[model samples]
Target chain A: MQPVEHPKSLNEVTADKIRNAIVEGELALGAKLSEQRLADLLGVSRSPVRDALAALQAEGLVVISPKRGSFVFTPDSHVVDELCEHRVILETAAVRLGITRNPSELTRQLAASCDAMQSALDAGDPHGYTRADHQFHNAIIESADNRALAKSYVLMISPLKALRTHLFTIMTENTDRSLSEHHLVLNAVRDKDPDRAISLLSAHVGHLAEAFRANLSTSQDGKISPATLEA
Target chain B: MQPVEHPKSLNEVTADKIRNAIVEGELALGAKLSEQRLADLLGVSRSPVRDALAALQAEGLVVISPKRGSFVFTPDSHVVDELCEHRVILETAAVRLGITRNPSELTRQLAASCDAMQSALDAGDPHGYTRADHQFHNAIIESADNRALAKSYVLMISPLKALRTHLFTIMTENTDRSLSEHHLVLNAVRDKDPDRAISLLSAHVGHLAEAFRANLSTSQDGKISPATLEA
Candidate 1:
């Protein structure tokens, strides 16, 4: 993976590099991650690579088996389904809390995110669009003003993002429709209708759930590796 | 803080000792946790003490300041309110999901836990009662069959248990009421009514929130510390 940004420490830089590589699908599912091989590939020492692997293990993107060493997380269909359901419950709750606490401010932030997403779509920048999409949801979660909610949401979604790396790339059927859904959620929030906002948010996450299910069905061989058992 | 059980590893034993101390009020809020001091207190070495502190930090029971050593978490009134709100949202969602998926089996498990809780109370063993209480809620979360939900719920609630230690000791006035509430929730789940289960679970957690609020109001110094800011 190509290094994009300079982090404060070499360990952090190595970790982010490896994280980006996994999320961008450069590292295939269930692929073995030898510290030496990664160090050689990234032109870094094995110490930093080891630290990076440990960091990835915490983020749920990598798993270590007792005898088999580390591998990229390769969840089975059942895991994916559970992850999707968890996401729906969490994101819906987040949006409802967001609407309840600060309707006008949350609406304004989401509207700005939506505009940025639209611009990215128009510019044919899927990477930019994805970044903005992540920010949009993060803003909604933060707006809830609940540290525990936000922490739990992050812990649950981080692994799902790794699972979605390739699926998101392939599920390019309806950017325009997704953008419109965002606007609808913003409108519901702006109107201070928590019920409507929650319904829209559920449907929005439901769309991702469908895509994850479809991807899982099409890719039958991507079973959970032995390493994931430790996780 | 006395060692009750031998864990599989030294790190685990050290972590459990510190966790128990914090929860049982042997370690006070804002109390500095020097690695050397903890090691000496626990009759262990500094290495394991440091590892234990790191593990406790992950559980939200300990915080490491930039300049100061680790300390027990000291959440103020606002943080307690947010924590209670988060618990209500998550546990209610969990009960609803549990009701939807495996009502009979979940109801059976919760009933068993209620029996265990009653037995503990009859024996005048508050610690045993607390353990059973935790298992009861854990059963509900796991009944949803979502690993991520269970993980998130554990992550969110682990810290709150510290706040409950003292509150639970003093809030003995409603033991019978809480027991009856658990039975009502079990009945609602057995009846396959998600709404009733959610409402009962919400009220059940609401009682804790009320107690926490009352405690915070009476004890003004029990505020979120600078260490918690670092957290």
Candidate 2:
């Protein structure tokens, strides 16, 4: 968690730190989060910490037991599948909206992001590749020019990041194939073809399904500590 | 705002009240909220109120300015269009998933909810009928058995409710016709026919679009005081 200096707003710092922990998976899903422990960890009062926790709770990333404590939210397979489906819907819509609204500018950005992603792939740096991928999709949403769509994207960011964290660490030969599909998506988006972009995005979503079904139990997203539930 | 009688939990109450205000259009889109006045009006302390404000800030119902207080989220027409389109995606997918997974149960619930909606309409109550309409759709999402979908459904709840509050008041003539569409959708879901359900749901979404297009500026969610911005 990054610390802020110069009279930082307590809740802002607390929310950011907690968001970092969950996004980075330093605090694993379903791990108990004690207010006292967190207060000690962040060297802050519990008041702001509680407020921050409430905010995260609203985001569906944390669950609280009235008398007990808070824990990182642990989602089930059904949850993950539904989220993936939701992503497919939003992403495909973004692609269509992007193409329809601003073809040239979007195509230019897509080409640029593709270049960056390709460079990252060539350098064998998953971090760079992931950053590029994030920017690429974000650009698609921006091009869609729909604040609500972008907000939905923001809502999905945390869980998607969690998924990516687990996914990135488990490298397989599919990495190259995945990049190849990205190329196809880029080509489709560049051509300003909504149908093709949607199909590619569908295949992209289907790939996640394949990954989950092939190794349902092995999803690194599945890491819950019973101790947390009892905490 | 509902007050709690137990330990100090002003944040929860603050969040609920603000959300209601937004949904009711008492807080107009893009209008700034003063925290102190809101605290005074709602008769609570600032800490919990700020916490509530922050939560809504996250929900995209309110926008928080740096060093400034929160403002009502005023979405433009494009955003409205995009959100409705996304609703179509989720509802359609829900139909597809629900019909395949639990056709019998969903069929029964749809029949019940739709019938209830008709009863409410016969009773000449738009509000009751609207609720039945909501439940009929919600039942399908529940049948999908996806917490992610369920969560998205929850998230979508406020916006739809806001839209309904805006459009339903003037949509008396469309009420009976809309309920009939619900019946058609129920028939498809009962038959476990995803395609037919999707078609009906798509048309159902389209009807809302037509209604809104006819009266785009009439806001349903209530407005709040600009003074609510200060804390």
Candidate 3:
């Protein structure tokens, strides 16, 4: 993730800075985050830093221990699975509503995203690719014309972004395959096949779950079932 | 919603108090919420009341309109429709997961809720019925055992609860029908029919959307298409 530039409110900027740090693992998960230290590092007042922590807390990135202090959320495989399941449910519904609402527009946006992914891959810019990737799915959700669905989808995906930040390299490794899958999904939408679109979208997200499970097993030597791995 | 009894922190208490007021429409939608007045009314200092307002704002029940101060969120038909659409998506997914993960327990909870609804109907208690109705759906969500889904569902549903508060009588009118529908969906679940359960859940939430649409047309002369009403 990139650091946000100035000119925005200090509170928002500080929150973004802290969030990026946590996402990039500059702040170790489960490690204490002192407001004084963060404020000093960010060259801001403690009040603004405190506000930033509150914002992060709401996002589930930082947990505040009553007696201790704020800490980056320790990764939980169960939480990741839950998040992936949520994404599958939401994105599948989005595909249904999105294509039904305006198949041509949704297909066009998704095709543009596919092109953007190609450019990012050609340039070897994983960050840019990730942004376009998010934009691609976001366009579908937006086209569904359901604000609540979009909002809930975003909220559920936030922590997963943090998870992605941790396994940034692993996620990047799948980009070429992901790009192809994106096009397949886009083609399904273009063909006006909601069932095919939903199925493809499920498999696409389910692929991420596989990656996550592999990472989890490697990191923790813990087991996860294939049944639980279906996004 | 019933008032949460004491033993909670003042911040939690104040937050619940304000939330109940907003949901009950004791505080009108779009009405300015003065911190001083709220503090005086709740017999607390402004600090806790301010915290409560922040909590309420996050839940979408209250809006802090920049320098204009906090206000009850103005009810919006579009938002209600969006919320209903979200409910349909999440609950249908929940029905699938709940049945797949553990059919018997989920069936037991839904059955209990169905009985609760029946009891409330027989007792002529709308408030109790409303509470049971929420608990019923909540059981479905919780039975999915996905914390992220439940949390996002609650946040998205908050404002709709406020809308329900405004049209409490109208909502209660469909109770008997709703209760019957609940049993129909529960029977599908009990029969181990995920597809049937999902379809019924979709229709059940769709029914609410239709009712809300009719209410919206009556209240604001705002038109929503029946086509957009389906999940």
Candidate 4:
């Protein structure tokens, strides 16, 4: 794969930037992203930004809520948990093949992600931790070496960044626990132990399921700052 | 639960009809579908038909090929096999719950779909068989009782119908084999055997994968008749 990373046109770049913003929750979930304001922010025309919005909506990252206009598509706790379940299904299948096909490099890559995770945790910034958390799992998905699997994983989980950021805050409070899971997962992958890797991954995704439910149920109780934890 | 099937709007129904036409080869994969012509054929305005086209494009039944305009997305055999692998990931997960919950009515519903499958098989028309195949899997997915699962399943596979239909013509020659496997799958579900159901379902989907691959080789040998077999 050649670096294929560069977009030929500014529209593509703008679309991706907006898409990442939607994913990382620089844009609010269910918030209507004004096209004019976004164009101004991006220093581009409304046409490209609108095109970007259409692209994101097509990806289901944004919902064109009929006459009301386009807003970020927020998955409630139930959908989030379902996505986690979907993750387990696809990722488990991936691990069955991925760990066998490549173990040593997989371990190194995951360990690298762990380094970022630890740094983000120490920084005590929810946003940094959120991205690091994404990269941590991303290493495994990429290791799976199945383009379709990786695409589905990203498409299905892309909308959950908000909820994920919220959960990362809770996990950051017990910082060591988050970093510890990475070590266990990396080791499982390194040992070429599919079952252990899958179990660890499943538990990792499932724990987020339960924790998010708890947060959704009681986020307004005032002990935690919602802004600090916003997905 | 009461009958949960929501009545689709005219545009939605039109989209389904057009999608099937393209997928079943009534409209030929890669054949351009003119909005005005389709609107006249369906006795609807181009506006709704355009909306339908957009919807089908989202579903992937149609490709709005840039500049050249819209055409039915005709996937080759390689894409078919890959798409089947995706279905395996989804259907296997669905059957896990299908057997785990042991819902009695679910059996009867799938039984009805099985009967329809038999009728389609007896019809011996590839197009009819393809329609039946769609219904059969749609029923099985719904039996899984998870909306997110169903949505993900459609999102993953719907656009790839040209490939699936191309695969269907080859697999229909083994209709009895497929039906037998379906019976085993249904039996596993009825037995409240999650493990068995998942295994059988995985193998069933795997059969489709093989069939998809077979279509490619058949095409290379010029054994596939686009007209008669594309029925």
Error of 3 at B99 (Å): 1.0
- Which has the greatest DockQ? 3
The count of residue-pair clashes in candidate 4 stands at 3
Q: State the DockQ of every prediction.
A: 0.48, 0.46, 0.65, 0.41
Candidate 4 clashing pairs, residues 3+ apart or interchain: A162-A231, B60-B159, B127-B231
User: Which structure among the candidates has the greatest lDDT?
Assistant: 3
Query: What does candidate 3's lDDT look like per residue over B1-231, in tens digits?
Result: 879654777877888877877676566667778899888877889877876787788788888865578877876778878889889889889988999999899999999998998898889887788888888899899989998888888887878776676655545457778998999999999999999998888888888878777776676731211111010
The candidate with the higher DockQ, 1 or 2, is 1
Of candidate 1 chain A, the 10-residue stretch with the lowest lDDT total is A222-231
Q: Which 10 residues in a row give candidate 2 chain B its minimum summed lDDT?
A: B222-231
In angstroms, give how far residue B181 of model 4 lies from its true place: 0.7
Off by over 4 Å in 4: A1-11, A34-51, A122-126, A166-173, A220-231, B1-18, B31-71, B74-77, B122-129, B167-172, B221-231
TM-score sort, best first: 3, 1, 4, 2
- Runs of candidate 2 with Cα error greater than 4 angstroms are A1-10, A170-173, A191-193, A212-231, B1-14, B17-45, B63-76, B166-173, B191-193, B216-231
Candidate 1 at residue A170, lDDT?
54
Model 1: CA > 4 A from native: A1-15, A35-55, A170-173, A220-231, B1-14, B37-51, B170-173, B220-231
How much is the lDDT of residue A23 in candidate 4?
56
Tens-place lDDT per residue, model 1, B1-231, is 996764457766787778877776666677778888778777889876876776677667889764468888876777777777887777788888888888888988999999999999999888788888888988998898887777777766866787777545555437788789899999999998889988998898888788777876776544323222100
Give iRMSD, candidate 1.
2.0
Predicted candidate 3 versus true structure: per-residue lDDT over A121-202, tens digit per residue: 8998888898898889888888898878887877677677766656655453588789999999999999999999999999
Interface RMSD of each: 2.0, 2.5, 1.2, 2.6
Ranking by lDDT: 3, 1, 2, 4
